[model samples]
Target: MQFSADTMFPGDLFEAATRFAADTLAAGDRANAWQQAVAMGWPALLVDEARGGAGGTLADLGAVIEGCARHPVGLPLVRRCAQAPALLMAAGSAGADDTLRALCAGQVDLDVVDAPALTVTALADGGVRLDGVLEGVDAALPFTHVLVSAGALLLLVPQDALPAPTARFVGIDGAQIADRVLSGLLLPASAVLQRGEAASSAAAIAQDLAIFATTLDMAATLGATIEQCIAYLSTRVQFGVALATFQVLRHKVVEMYVDYESASVLLARLVADTVVTGRLAARDVALCKLYLNELARRGAEASIQLHGGMGLTAELPAGRLARRLLCAGFAQGDRLTQLARLATEPTAARL
Candidate 1:
């Protein structure tokens, strides 16, 4: 039942993604990075094939993520971007088709309602009222539209229709997090994406996909960080030939490698299971998220600590990995939130 990475990424997708990541990752320029990703057609990774996208699977996206791990863009790009298009494809409506085209063309970005600062209210005449302040929006790209969830119902609201952003929070890597108060902004009936049962169902599907994609991306990023750490430890000299010669540092590297492999195996199995079932294995996703978060933190901290005084320096890749790992926790749900969900799942199912 064990699945290898080759079983998931079957073509040049891996090579293309790796080359793209290598060229653009950690460039410290969002505009340049986004343009490169668009050129590679990565933003449309999961859009339906008929929609002018590459029409690839989650595994393809996983390969791109793995390749980009040495230098990551953002979780939302894989999570929300991929998830939104999938939902639009599912809607199979005229509006969805238009949005799908825009998304695949890399003309707009999508937002997830993770922080819940905005409130959606049903208005008479079939319109909806959105109020309250939305905070912690991971808006790295200049978005043309946003997907907002109201009462678990997915609603597509044009960015122009929403209130202007009044404040912003910037990440250590220069990513922008927008905060805005939507004061009684009214969306027409046409903005209704999924309502009633269909609305919640689409939300669940998108959320599940986001969780699964984020887990694989985390594994890839951490795995690359571990490799870099091992190389540094094996070459840097101490009182002896190299730091790798030390049994303690060697043990640390081995443990971190094993952890990375374990996470990778778990992710592969989940991918296989999803492909086979045509549905998300929620219990497993929760476990993978919880398990990988701890691994990412430990691996990053260890990489930095093992690198000695130069570890935390900006020039060192270890510091960058550590910083990224620390920053990405809140993107989906944080580790604590994921852990609580995992605690309720059957122990046997997580395997």
Candidate 2:
């Protein structure tokens, strides 16, 4: 069966994003993809209208994400548009207004890093020194700024203040990642985006929202990948008959469909809860993250297996979609990390 995200977003907006992704992202032009997405006001999707943004809801953002993911577009909409805007809203500071405007206008790109590896030292001059290595930060090339989460404090550092990434790699979906070594980098009090009890609380909420948003994007990608598998099975012939005609292969397709639909139902409820109540139950979000990760893994492997050797080749969408699904599973927090977090929750103590 064909999967469409028309119900999630306005028809015009969804179509526009799909067309753009197909035309631009098909060539792997993420830089141009970023610019075009900006021109379309995508970065402002989650920002408030009062703050020079469209003030759209998280579900609305999901629609755009789904549209792009239909072509398996790998732009960092979740990080830049959804998470960054939420962070700025939660940690508004003296220069945050200009930062938000620039971000929404696509004049700048930003990524949030939760660096447990970093050692933060408070200096007598009301500054802090940072030293450590930041691992697996999902950022675009030439990241103009980075929002560093060091313990209870959040620091916004410009690109020039830090050296080049110690290592760079590409994610399965074609986004850029960096591993940076921070050695005695100093930040004045002014660089602190937020701190203390209130800041810590806001940062946690922002992180939860980002994780939930990533799950939503993963669901979209998985759905599209399933559709890709179905299309492939229905067309390519072997032994003088279409693969879809085979009972075993058809059952595999059915299994994938069931997984996608089941996840969709759960995601629908969580998204609605978040929209109505303005937050998700932490336990529910964690559970959903793990479920979707496994679902993506299953779908990717199945798609690959069904396509045989060709599925592993980049020339086909199967490979790209599989890569994206596998990689996205690790975003926000990997399976092991999330599980450990759940183990520490108050509710988990009952078990």
Q: Model 1's lDDT to the true fold?
A: 0.70
lDDT of 1 by residue, 1-351 (tens): 111222234358777766666666545566677666766677787776788778777777777777666565553565545667667766656766777787778776666554344577899978788888767655666566677766655678777876767888877644577877888888888888667766666665667677777777778777777767877876788896888788998788778888888888878776776666666666777777788788888887888779987877767766777777766555567888887777775544311
lDDT by residue for model 2 (232-330), tens: 888899999989899999999889888887887778767776677765666777888888989989988998999999988888887888888898899
Candidate 1: misplaced stretches above 4 Å?
1-11, 26-28, 73-76, 90-94, 115-117, 172-174, 343-351
Number of the predicted model whose lDDT against the real structure is largest: 2
lDDT of 1 at 350: 18
